[model samples]
Target: MREETFKKRKPKIVVIGGGTGLPVILKSLKEKDADITAIVTVADDGGSSGVLRRSFNAVPPGDLRNVLTALSEIPELQREIFQYRFKSDDRNLDGHTIGNLIISAMTDMHGNIYEAIQLLTKLMRVRGHVFPAAEEPLNLHAQYVDGSTQTGESKIPKKGKKIDKVSVTCVEKERPVKASRKVISAIMNADLVVLGPGSLFTSILPNIMIPDIGDALIETEAKVVYISNIMTQLGETEELNDADHVRVLHKHVGGKFVDIALTNIGIVPEDYIEQEINEEYLLQVEHDFKGLKAEVPMVISDDFLLLTEKSVYHNGEKVAEEIFKTAFNSQRKIKKYL
Candidate 1:
């Protein structure tokens, strides 16, 4: 391709997270010309993914599946095929998402999860890339409020105990599959690196837990921005406000991992609040990012969340839009080679 063609391309953006939050960001960012690489955490151990991981000795595929669907250009048919879940009744297909089974099978065929994801990305014609944080099947270990340890990522929240801290454990030598050279290069060369609106412990932090990945993020010259969660997670971040979130993140990856923090300042409508109370089990609180005294400046906006009928999350487009605005503003003032 010509240099002009490439230069006309949007800035490269690497978003790190897993599960629903990642896709929401991806979906919004894809609208822009930016190149997106979603580096997903693979420590999930629940649902159809849990069954496959235990049976086949594979990295949990639920998060990967969600990311794939989010980036995929295909219509409802392909997405439905990928997201199809079997019933819990007696059958060989029970409790498994079609995407998980397909990914597991691809991993078996290619003998690696990385290769399988690459293949699927090509098949789906994703706008950007999606890679697992590590090649090995990993487990998340958490120390609870009572000082008890929980082993699985899925089980940690359900335990109903406050999480004291969290860490990732690999089945093999702790060398984190060395984040794809392309990913590291992207981070090193990126104009902006976005963390997440995902789960603090399970989704977002897992990426930083990888030593090499964390090192790359820390060493990268790009401006780093973290999008804080809007509501408190039941078990993981029970009473955590914006400042508490940053403190926990600092404790894990040290204070230098972030450059800026973007948080929602909007209020949920009263009807929306009632719906959240009855269905989603979430309560909105004022995020205290001001108290963090972070090195990077913090930006707050009235980016209201979109609530779904499923009683879970709505789209994160408003937050993503604010993030892009902040990034663009930052880049305009700071020269690329500076």
Candidate 2:
């Protein structure tokens, strides 16, 4: 009876980070009917999001927009329209995306981003919650191994230097970036907290470095799982193995919070990625299973790669299955103890 009851209850899963990968896992989790909350990074100061952040003095809506669309139950056409980007000859709105503009407008109307996201999520019929790591736009600062420093997410990778550490600050003032009460609560109360298949430095760490969120991650009773990226990124995670990723995360969070790591053991076909076309993927991430086992309590290795259209991605369905399986077994153990 207890086993049956546990199975009936939806697992409260909180996924942290930003970038394209976050959404892929999110959409899959939604399909599984997990109670989801996405804590996204707002430290982006790049391209259309950067322009809007400067113009409107709003939270960078790019990451939040993608998360919203991913968990939304709205019609496919409306979702497309929400994600549509303008490519007009006109300079003003040429590179602007419709979703970014809408989110910015909504932020203005509500006078706060948290409320704006709540309202927007309701309208989109989002399956779960989407909260920005901070209410305001955050500026990402990186200290490279060579003692060099850089600000701004887009420009950080351009330096071509090894990043030793990264931190976030509010754009308007020299103050600590804060995650809202709800964001912290989500982490504290979650059944499982999943990190990345996204950019290690820019996307995932930005959210983790926020004091309250980082602390909650460390203090939370939930099992934390990290889905390691399939390919190595040029500047951020160049030549980094799966364990190196976990070490960076632990170094930032100040604790060995990641209980399990989901690593991709599948191989990408050689000459599969066009260098010019897919500049982001520098090389396939070499697996160091021993090093990975040292970082986390348990390592889950699988063929978690999805290759399509000359791009490499996590096979979201398979990853989500592993996530729920982990969460379910973890929950069942807790229930047994009770």
Candidate 3:
């Protein structure tokens, strides 16, 4: 390769997950100028996305919408238009978000959700590439604490029972959507890979459930890092501490536990804790890092919490800064060995 070509090559980063968490991380990583690839889970079956999936046989568009918004550099007006939802007395428009409908329409025209997203990405001039874990709309099935099973991703958390395990089902067994050949090439050449800060079962684990996808992660030579969530989700991860989160993830991904586990150690103010309690939510239990698998080192940061009037959550910029700091430190150590 020529020297000019080497200078133009951006670091390749593969981020795995869905829901709100992955987008936040993506937003921050985009600033660092990495060649970003997001592998999003497509099993969502709720609200507008669920309606489109059931009615049109399209891949769930909710996560894809979030990824688009995160990567968007357009004006706020365009972004809000993409996120607008329809509300009406008419049953047809009752609960659909405009973005879901737009994506569904594009899928119909383009003949595939992936292609629809590519068109949108080009229009938005997003900073990176996005891919779904599977091409078909998938159902998330789970065994619950009450000994019954739930069949949809949206319904699973509402069951108010402990989740034993989660798996995907289609009318037939679906192969892992082969990531763009470029995505696999990125993984092979990457310096690091990141997972989580998202819903454990719903967001992160679903990606690995895809057979070839799981193999890709395990086979990649990159160092894998997991960013832990700041709070437990109401129904699905009700009482899961950080270590429990890691263990559940290990159970799903087999033996591929992360090389390093990054967790937020900041204490939420008492008022914020009370606010969450008032809303019927609980703070995540402090992680027992010592009890987790001995091989992974736990890195903690006090700057994790972002306390706002409406919500208390992780600050993506702060989290990403910590991740990059840790990753580079690891790289330096590896270079010494080489």
Candidate 4:
């Protein structure tokens, strides 16, 4: 009876994206007791993740590792211990985070990434599901407006050329890699689908570009909400306002699919803004409510900014609060039809 009651109440929320921003949102969602499923990108090819993928022929584990930490129902110290990276003289161990190594080792043990994450999810006591967008290390293929094709998630932004569109190609072609059916099912069942607070092209679109995933997204009954990035990514989304971001997403998906677009209206301090450019290479994202309202059905602008001494970013709790409000309203509307 308790199990049935718990299942009936939990809001099914599926978040699709990768990178550092994903974990921030997941941390808050776990606290909400939502039935969370994080569909992470497998197109990472930078730093330790890239090195491991190249060396061991394993799927990049960095994004998945971070998401696991966010959802883990364990002591804070234990989570920090898992995230620890070696800072020693040993050439083999140095520069590699422990969590990345653990994931890579498990991927080898289970002979696949999906099974590996499931096993690690149990051991880590993760409060939700985390699935890689692809079972294999994915190659991000982007064609720039200059008529050039760039391959690799890290390389895409570095080119400094306008991206025409992006697509994913699996590294192990013979292995028959694709976004897991489990991920597809989660999207189908979700009450609220959150797209991002992450990189638009590299993090969010890679998952959507997968043909099977794209089809499911178009067919799903869920209200797709895009969390506009708090800042404009210099190379990827320079000069784009909130509405422009939404349109780009619709353009790629080939339909007006996003039902709502969430944006930040709070001003980022110029003092903090300069540091963001120097340290993180991001500029404050501007919004055009007129454009957003015309394109998306609903546009909610709120104070989602979290200002810090080091960087400027989205306040996860504030964003999650907005998400839950939408979720509840969606549930009510669905019941009216039934």
Candidate 5:
């Protein structure tokens, strides 16, 4: 009986990605009580993070700040304080977020990115593990189909070129960075691994581009599930269908090995989508379910769609609930009665 109970343990889920999309799912997964290990990308090179990186040579903290806030158990007031961005025009403080600065300070104190996260986890009362994909800041390099190459995550999309592949290197250096052993161990031990609803190229790929983490994805016993973005991203994934997303991921990873693609299929009220003026989120993601299933091992669809006041998003709690059930089912052994 003890053995059976042990076998039915809570699912260990490692979620990979960064940007606004990551926090949405994480907050949901935390409520569902899954063991979550968020492996965030360090390839950020724009805005407040970029300015700080240049000024202090620190790892980009914007993504980490958001993830920490998402999983933080602190009261809403405190969490909000951390997430507050200054709107001042002062050269010293304009566009800087309090959370980013805190992370920067933490990084400086510990002299280690990993250690800083641990300290913040305790302070923020975080529910589960949060890890930086690499200790050092990373630069994203994209090789476009036209045989052209560009470096920096912020600049890649602006070129308006079709991406062939992408890789991560040490920021301002040429060497490849490897994820810490803990990040790899989390993936190896997880019952299920989830990729993003973020920018596939910039947010998700950078984490997997690390040599060891990439290899772990190919080798880990864990089931891999990808959360498809609800809407098309203009530069990164414009005019692409669901199948195209899967194809891009597999091509970069060197195989069609992703076990499942959890896609959002529910129709958005056309007027609801139109109310927002941003052109990027206007179109719902196109579907090619047959193609996704053909390349990825399995494809699952649902009404994971969510709408905030001004935008559409994946309902994180819904995703977490479904993902937990799927992982639990995949990992548990069901016994038949005679």
Candidate 6:
């Protein structure tokens, strides 16, 4: 009976980030015995999301749309339909995805992105909570090593300069950027807070740059784990290693907040990545065990690579297993202390 009860216990996890990587992790976590809350970045100002952000002054929907689909219990066909993008000569609708448009319309109806996401989470039967990091769209600013700064998520990396640091400012309003109403509470309540398998400067840092969300992460009793990216990114993390990733995050948060670091030791075939895949991926991230040890208390290094379609990604199932185990172990230790 004790074993059965242990198996049935659910760990509350809050995943924070945006971009292509966020949804991939969310999809895998949905299959686990974990209650999940996704705190997504709204600092996107590129692609279809950017166009909508400019047109409707709504929170960029692309990341939120992907997150919604990843956690939704809806049928596969419906999910495909929601994600479907139109290709046409018509300039107005050609680049916009069905999900983004729907989210834009919903934001208009609800008068805010937070409420829009909440209602859609139910309508689509999303298994967990999804909240925007900020209520309004935000602009990302990156300071380069040369003392130059660039703004806009899509525009930052395009400058091809090494970034020193990044920050976020309110886009639609001049007021200080704020996390969505539920974001702080969710982080404080989580059993584990997962940072990223996403872009370091653009996707992950933008969420943490928000004052309240960063504070919540620091104050939360939950263990913080970073799913270090497997490959280095061009114009972003060009030559960064696993430890550099942790160090940068630590600096942004003002202290060593991360308890664990998940490092990928899997090998990627040198010639396997196709041209499209190489666009962002410069090389495999070099390992820096000594540096990682200096930042985090624990490091779990393993073959977390998933290669397919001429690209590299984290093995989501493997990652979810480790995450659940960590959360469960921490809970057991806490209970013993109590």
Model 6 lDDT per residue over 154-241, tens place: 9999999999999999975569988889788778877899998899999999999999888878888889999999888989998899
Question: Between 4 and 5, whose lDDT is larger?
Answer: 5
In model 4, the clashing pairs are none
Against the true structure, what is each candidate's TM-score?
A: 0.88, 0.96, 0.88, 0.93, 0.94, 0.95
Clashing pairs in 5: none
The lDDT for every candidate, in the order shown, is: 0.76, 0.89, 0.74, 0.86, 0.86, 0.89
- As a whole number from 0 to 100, the lDDT of residue 234 in candidate 6 is 86
- Say which prediction, candidate 3 or candidate 6, comes out ahead on lDDT: 6
Candidate 1, residues 308-332, lDDT tens digits: the string is 7554453567766766665555442
Which window of 10 residues has the lowest lDDT sum in candidate 1?
329-338
Candidate 6 colliding pairs, count:
0
Q: Name the runs in model 5 displaced over 4 angstroms.
A: 172-174, 332-338
Give Cα distance to truth, residue 315, candidate 6, Å: 0.7
Model 4 CA lDDT for position 245: 90
Residue 88 in model 4: lDDT: 83
Candidate number achieving the greatest TM-score relative to the actual structure: 2
Candidate 6: the clashing residue pairs are none
User: lDDT tens string, model 2, 1-338?
Assistant: 97788687788888999999999999988898678899999988888999999998889899999999999999999999999999999989999999999999999998988999999999999998888888988888999999999999999999999999998888866676788658888887788999987999999999998888899899888999999999889889997999999999999888799999999999988868654267887888889999988989999999998988768989999999999888766663332111
Q: What would the per-residue lDDT of candidate 5 be over residues 1-338, giving only the tens digit for each residue?
A: 87788666777889999999999989988887577899999999999999988777878999999999999999999998998989997988999999999999888988988899999999999999999999988989999889999999999988988888999888656665889649988888888899998998999999998988888898877889988898877668878888898888888888766999999898888888778766655478887888887987788888988777868889888888888988887673323211
